[model samples]
Target: MKKTKILFYDMKDYDIEFFTKYGKNYNFEMKFLKVKLSEETAYLSRGFDVVSAFTNDDINKNTIDILAKNNIKLLAMRCAGFNNVSLKDIKNRFQVVRVPAYSPYSIAEYTVAMILAVNRKVHKAYIRTREGNFSINGLMGFDLYNKTVGIIGAGKIAQILIKILKGFGTNIIAYDPYPNYEIAKELGFEFVDLDTIYEKSDIISLNCPLTKDTKYMINRTSINKMKDGVILVNTGRGMLIDSVDLVEGLKDKKIGAAALDVYEEEEEYFFEDKSSQVIQDDILGRLLSFHNVLITSHQAFFTKEAVEAITVTTLENIKDFIENKPLKNIVPQDNN
Candidate 1:
């Protein structure tokens, strides 16, 4: 039997290396494409049995139509997020599978890092110390012990993070529509309502998926309900927090400090080197002007373990599709 041929869009160097290595053991041939997948670029996958896409790729109805027209049978999402894909369009036309769980510790640890970095002014201190300004004059950090941390999602990553935070003796209050009571009991955290999460937490971390209810969920109204000088960190999807409202929140000191690994409207800017060019996005530009904010190029999921798991899980998804096996990572049309 011939091996299945897969066309991989948005191929990073690491992706090519990992996929090529792992795919060899699985009897699959992967053709790497660096271009972002779009309706026009769907032609590139012609004759291929499967198309593997990334988080940032455009996988709308038009792109799905073109992909179907070009004889693509399956879409293997190499990342956990499938928000970009038009699941309705691909419902019966083609199968869709994704890497639902990579190394949760990668993001869980990164979320903790962001919290510590922003709270202790580590980023600023690194810059100042590098310039021989060792003065700790403006560098002030608070204690984590006995502090209240409200997590919006109580999923795998959130569970891991709560365990880590518990080591610091901080109170963990969570809000999830579908609460895993067993995990809450096992992890020793409270499952509170959204309003209680907003008013009570000293530090608010977003670890939820981007859904209709969560889109721009952290807007002006929500921020207003938060404690004065509350710290905020987002390692989740960008649109979870409205950038415009976030800027306003930062301006008014409603949010004492903010650290973001993802941003709204980040598709055009993130994952690219635009060091020489002016930041044309006004909201992003305003965000950069804030002294209390730290932004990272969405790298929370870039750990070695995460990458390995992502590659293996994605290849497994592809294998299951080709072999007509039950897919473990088949994402539902809507996460409603």
Candidate 2:
């Protein structure tokens, strides 16, 4: 029997190791492609049974068409979020599978870290301490205890965040269209409307996936409803919150501070380093100038545990496709 050929695009060291180890057990031959998946690079998967992609790869309609033309049947994503892929266009072209739940704790913990760093000015304090400036004049911070925290989308990551915040004695209010009643009752969280959350929360965090209805959910109108000097944190989909509206809010003192792990226009340059070159994006450049805002390189899911889980699940997805088995993380076209 001939071994199944698997092509992994934009894979790192751990990704290669995981597939090499697990794929051998199933007699699958693995090939690695370091280039980003695009129309030109889709040919790399030619003659392969399945193609595995990373978070930053472009799996658009053209790329999918190219893969389909080459007889590739499966598209396995190593990340939990599938917003990067064009689901509508590739629904009939190939079977799409993703690692839906990979270390929610990693992202939840990182969100908390961002909140703490912003509220307590820890990032600035660390820099000052290294410069031999031990003055604690502007390092004052308020307590998290008894503060109202509004969590958007009560999913796995949000649930984990709620659990950790519960220990801090914070009042938690959540807004999710599909609320998990069991978790809400257990955690003593109030499932209220979005408007109420905006009006009442001292801090707001976005943990929802990006969809047609959810894109630009947090815009100028919603920001107006929020309390003055409210802290905002986003570790979810970049497009969920409009970057323009956020910048205006920050300038008008409507938002006290913000910490972002994702950006709306991140595709042009997120993982790549363009420090030596000029940043062409004006909004991003302006965002960096604000002292109250902290931006990360979409690294909330960069922990060792998360990386391992993603790799294992990705390989399993490919294995399931080749073996004619049901996929645990298959992204259905219709949510119904």
Query: Which of the numbered candidates is closest to the native, going by highest lDDT?
Result: 1
All candidates' TM-scores?
0.96, 0.94
lDDT by residue (tens digit), candidate 2, 1-336: 888888888866766777676666676788887777888899878889888887778888799889999988888888887887887777566888999988999999999999999999898899899999999888787899999999999998999999999999999999999988888999899999999999999999999998888899999999999999899999998999999999999999999999999999997778777889988999999898888888999999989888778877887788888889988889886322
Total colliding residue pairs, candidate 1 = 0
**lDDT of all predictions:** 0.92, 0.88
Stretches of model 1 off by over 4 angstroms after superposition: 334-336
Report the poorest 10 consecutive residues by lDDT, candidate 2: 327-336
lDDT at 46, model 2: 82
Name the lDDT value of residue 145 in candidate 2: 100
Q: After superposition, how far is residue 270 of candidate 2 from its true place, in Å?
A: 2.1
